[model samples]
Target: MGFTTRPELRGTFGAVSSTHWLASAVGMSILEKGHTAFDAAVAAGFVLQVVEPHLNGPGGEVPIIVTPAGADEPIVISGQGPSPAKATIAYFRKLGLDIIPGTGLLPACVPGAFGAWLTLLRDHGSAELEEVLAPAIHYAENGHPLVPRIANTIATMRELFTTHWPSSADVYLPNGEAPEAGKLFRNPQIAALYGRILEEAKTAPSREARINAALDFWYRGPVAERIEEFCATESVWDVSGRHHKGLLTADDMAAFKPEIEKPVSVAYGEYQVFKCGAWSQGPVLLQMLQLLADTEIARLDPLSPDFVHLAVESAKLAMADREAWYGDSPEVPLGTLLSSSYAAERRALIGETASMEVRPGSPDGRRPILPPLMEVGTIPQPGLGGGEPTVARDRQLPNDSQGEPSLNKEGAQRGDTCQVSAVDRWGNMVSATPSGGWLQSSPVIPGLGFSLTTRGQMFWLEEGLNSSLKPRVRPRTTLTPSTVHRGGVPYLAFGTPGGDQQDQWQLLMLLRHIHGGMNLQEAIDAPAFHTDHLPSSFWPREISFGSVTLEARFPGETVEELRRRGHVVTVGDPWSEGRLSAVAREMDRGSQIIKAGANPRGMQGYAVAR
Candidate 1:
């Protein structure tokens, strides 16, 4: 759960709120500016940097997967930066530092989320950076109401926020206290930063230069110098005077470059799965879908007890694999795990009987068992099945022509991340997930809208692990932005920022809507079950089974049945559930039905649509 819930906006366009009001405001502004969904999403990311500074900023990194309408090749963007040549395993070994517990500026990676936006502009946007960034600029200058979620998170982590950066304490802790919700929060410093970007863009001839100028201001220019000077005097980087690289230098800031990459996609029945490469846990999501396809899930009823049971079981299985083999592929053969043959073999292991025992199995390829479709009540369509029949559309993205395998998966963490989805009248769509790691780990630069990331905490300190934080190695991440298409047209835009929980939440939503035929809200609202069948990024060895929790919601007998299968069961409270925000578009007849949902777990979320 990163930011706020999904806001409902009508107009054939929608935006899900993040933790920051400025992020939402910027999202709405992007829509007003006539940018596509992707453009607005990128703008939201930029704006969120200002309002929610501790999580992520212009200098932060993000990994992405984007699929355009009617296009076969899915565009992948890696917002990650290479490890500085100064970093090495030996470098840490000499300092006797094996693990850095989730905090400190030294752990910041080269920020690439800004670069990811540039990639989107090159491939998808038509507007200039100023237009895309107008909303954030306005909010930064004019100020916005501090929503409940932002206020709460700030209050909860006030110590961390103030301790990380003195400027953050000055801004977030106005009046020497965290403001309550509905209070007018203002940040003229961030506003000035935006004003500068807009002023520079007016004269900047090339789109690239305009975007670069904005980015440069955050890093190598005045911002970077201020941050360096502040850290030098504040003593924030002193880890007992060892492993202190002081503040991120101007050279580090100037050297940051985002990467454009080809995404890895795999077919699963009538639909296809697309994911960011090994640089993130995105591949784990697709692989889970592949394993699920081998089961009887695709054919199951949307809301039946059996359907829920099987889906939960399949999720646990997929999580198992994710925990085992997913990581930075640059140093390993992570892409081989996605081969069709490998998926088929894993599918064969799905036992009809429920089993508590779950393990990451050996890789094998085999054709999957055809699953049975469930009989759920549905409105009859013209010349379709009588009952509430499933809407099975025939559309699939073509595989990459070249056999170059997908690589790269490294660190990602959830501090405060939000996603936005928009679809204009022209059938253009956007899916974007903007993130900031936890507040205790990093600080927002003075007057900047966004914060530098604490992404380094997402990596493991243990050697021989996929998520291990090696010197000069990027970490695998879990921030994923996804788009779903039907009838060769973009229909759904969704993303989540729940750390490792992100993929599971997204997969459940996709499966329920695409295969199970649940409405957007229903899919998001359904009770969730997580699996610890694999190695969790945080936990070395653990697998959570949905059967255990599903049974808790139901009769005691169901739990008994799951227990018989050998699952370790632990029941949790109904409150404090994970949050999910998603937007979807469906065409019924000639009109469009645009729907969005925010997780019920939070108090602040609004969906505005006309």
Candidate 2:
């Protein structure tokens, strides 16, 4: 095996991998306390909200794929919240808007992360409510070392905070300035909030009842009241260059509940890979795998031009289908889309040269209908308030000429999503991608210390489409997590933090591990690449035809060959591409063993096992 940035952790006890080292440590601590993986993941998920606030927070969402010990299959905890009852295409059109702005109150949805964590703990976890929340409360009240990316994100939004969002300034800029990198930062409001919830929850009689009490407090009690009051009273400035009040209400919060559903799975070799339903972009990975099922993926060099070309082409095709078909509505023909025959037909489109056109297949003879496509370069360069902080090749702004913000000198964007995976000795496992409610996403609600999710921005303004704007319907979220079962048992759980690149990066890692025989660490450490050829899920949606960005670590010959084959190649900084982490379980000689690995990029992700 090639040299990896870190060793792939091996153990018989437990394993945890997460985008932030602090969260990973917290998860390991939970496991040491004799709790199940579900409990550990819930604790770690809350800690991620505290430690990686730029990437996620209490007001965000998380879609979790979990398989309990001896369970038949994995289940999905859908934490993604739906749009407000008042959010409608007519309302936005009346405001002279064709697309939802990426940031601010107008796009706020029902904050679902907190409720989802509560649901997971109530149903599958064994830990007490206060026990799991204590770590996050302690970190929020005292202090945690500020990551440079968080500091930089604050600095970028400093002017906007001070000018238009004083409530946000009060929490993020306590000393009238952006907190310095490596300095300790605290959000006492978050600490106080959770503390109060625990106080209220302790009045309950039993453990499960306490968890439900906490849920009620968040969705129907003081937290919901505050969110509703703020949204109704304040009109905040956003990326749309106007001030708008949010449509979310306390009733919306009261009516919301996280759904636990079965996952969608596809056979890949001897493994069954499972992902969240079409409400997210999870199916894209399954689609890509099916397209490559009959190819020569196992024989090709994982880093050669052939491998890269094959993966990028399959991604483009799957992403095209995502644009045309994926949504939270019942109209999605998911069965036809995931069938082997459809994949075989799609695979025949791969040629010697790259294809530039956006092509969606006719699944089961139903003609695909796509939303209006925006021309390249039509969207303006994003201001500090733009959602979905992007990783790009150049340090200069507008690197892609399609409105994607370039990387800063620190080699990190302002904020994105986060991933966490955990496996315990009891054989339970979880893979969750938590995202939205970025500090830049909206003004901090008064007294809440957190902002609402702008995930509703993913909805298209056009009607008669699967992803069109609709009240009480989920936006097609980009956050996706993966769980793989080997021969009917839980095997691996993994995910990453990019908006559109989440599935793309995971597909590369899985392909290399399954076909190239690389271990998790080596697969994660390999050079990463993704295509910008599909319409983006973020606001100011843009498309770049035939564009592929690769880390500079890829072979120069491979890069030149891709360009020769008609890809618009852009080389990124050596370690700028992926933030993947994974954990797996297997039996060896009648004993169970666990293994883990994390991305070395960003100097943050870590895997811990013992």
Candidate 3:
């Protein structure tokens, strides 16, 4: 590959990477202002909600992996919310559906991002809640440059907004027209709501107390009241064949709270990788690592056909297990599944040729019930399940309301979700993926200025499975962020925002870093590849066997060699895939220096230091 135009950003005090440059700047400014890493991360997260509304919102969820200074083990903070009390398989089946709609009110969960971020800030941060939130408020009340894709999404969905979701139309399509790209876009209603919350916080004597009060207001007070009232009354057309009311209520919102728990860790030689529990797909990385443990991957070229085949084959087995054995509930045998011995058995399945069969392991000596077998050739289409679009460039962006798609949709559009990675001089490090609740996900609540996450779309309506849809249960979410530590010291924070492809992209970067001896940006900028052999986690759950997508930068002989190995190969433009970003720390001059890098694809992700 040619030299990367975006070099690794190195600094002494801190480093930050996020989906938007403005968000990254705001975060670094917080760190430069003497705030803690936790404070910077929360500030950047809130800014991302304001600047990347097409990707994420306050109504969305975030899963965070955090490693504070001197801590031996990283912790997983679940910003992911649960389904409402009324979100039951029976209810969805009663609506004449076998699965929940991928977009709209019926799949709505309690908004968890605000409470989750506040919980982190109040507990670990020295900054006041108002200070952390001020940047988002400013951008929301005033304006920020609208990214081109968000402008295009608004234009395509304008009629749907104006006719079916007028409350949303009032907020997004001002005066009945899409906001032009690069124009200052403002959502003052959201600003006013947050302004009121901050004013209420002023009555509290302590900073921690003020942050707690804001959380209460968001979950049980006026904000929740407005959400409850709106969802109870309004119905909107979605990917479902018909319109439907929401299942979420104020009581559900009030009952919800983010949890801080231990992360599941996997060891690979000197490095220790940490990820969230079965509640997320984070552990998929661990499972993948274990499966590849015995492979002589180091002997193969990083861009060789052999290395690509091993990665894709391992991903197929691990992702199939994700479908059958992973979920928020404890019914999953995640412990046994992650064992090296179990991996030995599963790893043996990596044959010379690609297999179309979807197979999950029966860990703990019990049979695992798998989801319906999708035919391998059934390639997933964008928005097939009426899902929010993902980071994959191969898929089309938002289509217009009249069913007349964009005539200008010639080029492949880049991706989704908001991600922030921050590490400060004090040894504080965090990796977070905030997603769901896109503008197209649901009708906006009239006064709240955001929509509820449709994460429930990830759960199956089938009976007797780990991820079966149930009232008040957290859905198995795809939003995963990762942190790595070496010998009790935080070392790396890295993540991407692709849906099912998130872990896939991260794994490629990781192997290149460890096995190829490349630094952070070198690993990230290397050409990446992924397989569609397993069923997609998004709606429609489609499958495509032996289908591998590779950056065209790879040698032509290597590409053809993969096809000769019984793989179906497709070529993507160089640097066109993987919106991944990363931050790392190392000792320099008797002190630690921070380094960060963001993806250059689509010109959206930004990284900065010094």
What's the best-to-worst order under lDDT? 2, 3, 1
| Top TM-score hit | 2
- What would the per-residue lDDT of candidate 2 be over residues 209-238, giving only the tens digit for each residue? 999999999999999999999999999887
Error of 1 at 156 (Å): 3.1
Q: Cα lDDT for residue 332, model 2?
A: 93
Please, what are the lDDT tens digits per residue for candidate 3 over residues 314-394? 999999899888988878888888999999999999998877677888897788788776653353443423332222223
TM-score of model 1 vs. true structure: 0.78
- Model 1, 1-610: lDDT tens per residue? 2232343444555444443445555666666767666676677676666555434556567665565655665677777654443544465556665544234465566566766777786567767877776666676677777666566656655554454456567777887799788877776776777787678666777877787676667556876676556445544532222325433455665676666677776666555556677777777777777766656777765434455456556666565555555566554345556766666766666665655544554543311221111121231222312221111110010110000001111212124455555555555555666654334344556555445564554565555656555544566666777766565455666666555557767877788777766666666666554443433342111223333333133445555555555655444444233455666666778777766665555443333344
- After superposing candidate 2, which stretches have Cα over 4 Å from the reference? 380-412
Q: What is the lDDT of residue 257 in candidate 3?
A: 91
What does the lDDT come to for candidate 2?
Answer: 0.87
All candidates: TM-score:
0.78, 0.96, 0.94
Ranking by TM-score: 2, 3, 1
